[model samples]
Target: MDLKLVILFLFPVVIGSLGNLSLLCHSVFLYCSGHRSRSIDVIVRHLTVANTLFLLSRGIPQIMAAFGKQDFLNNVGCKLVFYLQVTAKGVSVSTTCMLSVFQAITISPRSCGWAELKLKAAKHIGRSVIMFWVLHMLLNIRVPIIVSDKRNNTNIMNIIDFQYCSVMISSKEKTTTFVALTLSHDILCLKLMIWSSSSMIFILYRHKKRTQHIHHSSISSRASPETRASQSILILVCTFVSFYALSSLMYVWFSLYIKAAWWLVKTSALTNAGFPTVSPFILMTREQFVCESTRKK
Candidate 1:
């Protein structure tokens, strides 16, 4: 129950939870206001929910362990918490990737092939969200068998501790299978996000050239709305990639290193929470910009 660890978990837990709650509230309000719902409105709702779950699952146990609660979670608790944490994290990545792709399609040229995607994408949001959850849940279904409260368990051949819960990798083969599955999940989502970001940037560049050619000058005395929207999505996607990559690198380093570094685990956990902690504010910025523009009108 180190005071430092308590303080570490508290910042992300308290601040991230509040920010995500606000974002969720704002999203729900917009949806129920009787006006047409934007694709982003739906995406934000799902994203915020996943972020909140991730923060809670990852944060609360650390906080409890910091408070000197030994064996605070039983075997069942470990399984449930670990399962929720990973599943929610997977959903967050997938949803953010979807957001970037949706934005790219939203801003793409009407005559371009992306236009057809726009028509189909909106209709599939609900189904996509369901698929993400189901896929991750099924993929990680082995979590329950592998995770247990350390105090209640006798076997400790290869245990990965998370302060309150421990994961027992029974054999090298199962470990390899688990790592492969998780890596595949993350790589696919990240690739889509990178592709979408590149497409958006290309589209924005072409737009800038068009405007400049028309005016024969440096365009944008003020940036266009489409430009502004694209910037927001770019920021969100880039931020997620930066934080997620750093956290993942730490994970890989830990796995490869011989001696266990509990400090490194704590650092990785904090870095892992970075996107969920920062994303709500990033999403809020777009609304602030939109509000300012509307008032100017």
Candidate 2:
């Protein structure tokens, strides 16, 4: 076993699990305590869930395999684990997009039509979250079908051989169709996230310009809670996009080049898991999250 690789994976698993768990508990505590959570908070709660699952689904198996445990996942385990990991990632992508879009709407000018849309959007957040889960789960229902236990990790014919959980992806037609659909979903998510982020940036810029005549201290006080929240979400979105792009490139490289080296495969897995490991800290920095956490203690 490579001690470095083991530590590398283990560190993120421990840190990410704790961070996500803290946020998850915090979100639940707010709702349970009858503290009204906004649409963005609700979305952040769900994003936390998906991130936790992504970490667990990938982390445990990788850790087991790193300890020289091979073929630990049976056929059923492989199918379930593989499907859940990918679906968790899909839900994460869609949820982040939703968060950004709503933040944009939240910060939009009151004169714009977004006023009504914002009200309705909050009302339908539950439906939207359900829709994201259903969409990703339905879209990847066949993921388990293509996944099975692999007898060997060095198979050039396999698309993904994770030592324990291997995916055959043997059907060319199915592979192409799945790839096309996934790309379509990701593209739409990316476009919406970028649009919303850009809109938020523009709005912030305009607000700053309008407040330029004010004293520096006044300007510091001028940053509203919404502005600060928007900025945090913007940072979260940027982190997600960076990891998402890296993971996508690695995915494409693996798809095109089947005989990828073992180090590259591990790198791809780490890249794919990056956002889940990093995002909760970005979110926990929210003024409300921190304040509430302090109050609870």
Candidate 3:
């Protein structure tokens, strides 16, 4: 069997797994060190948790294949794999959106619209996460309905994958319904993410611009942690836009066309899989404190 896909996917899986694990450990350490009560701590903890899910959803299966456990994921395994994969992907998207929105609210001006919103209402965040899980679970329940363990000439239409499953909607009506729902969901979520991220970018840009106008000699020479955090948020927004845009483009290409080349499939899968691999490094870049601590170790 060709091992090219496994080879191409190996680095991403290993890095994603390691990065998420480290992030989880770091979050735990922070909590133990009494940072547990901070709102940012809550966000970091959730982000770490979501990253771990992403690693398991995407990286573990590829790692298994890298070790020659290819067909081990059959039938029952497919259901579990697809369920976790979808759930994790959904969580990642939701969590990132939450992070962006949460940060935006955090930095809002006293007179800003969100000033009185009590935005991080921990109860609301928890409820939102629960609702996200429930909604995606229901939406993807049809995964098992459409996917099966094996493929045969008669059932080829229903078989989505050997390791993961999806609904096999072949009829015109079903296809139309699926396409409409998918497009609507994508448009709504992507719009919200873009708007939220762009707003943060504008706010940060204004802050940096204002800082430059003031005389450095008279002002505080030390860099504010808030400014560093803003830069980090900007990096994250750029990354989220870039990767999600690529993934969304690939999705459109696959959906709008019937003939998908082998390279296209591999590229799409690789790109989609690589997001979890790269996201942690971006987050880590913002944490100067953590990096300094690591260096001192």
Poorest lDDT segment (10 consecutive residues) of candidate 3: 158-167
Candidate 3 per-residue lDDT over residues 59-125, each given as its tens digit: 6665565566656566666667667666667667777777777677766666745665645454477
Off by over 4 Å in 2: 152-156, 219-222, 287-297
TM-scores of all predicted structures: 0.92, 0.92, 0.82
Each candidate: how many clashes? 0, 0, 0
lDDT tens string, model 1, 1-297?
589989999999889989999988887786688645776667778899999999999999988988999587888888999999989998899899999988888888897566778878988988888898899899889888878998855657567777788876567687789889999988998999999999999999998777765753434456776578679889999999899879888978766764457888788889989999999998888777665655566
- State model 1's lDDT: 0.85
By summed lDDT, the worst window of 10 consecutive residues in model 2 runs over 287-296
Candidate 2 lDDT tens digits, 145-230: 87888653345475666777776656678888999999999999999999999999999999888777777784556576667778
Report RMSD (Å) for each prediction in the order shown: 2.3, 3.0, 3.9
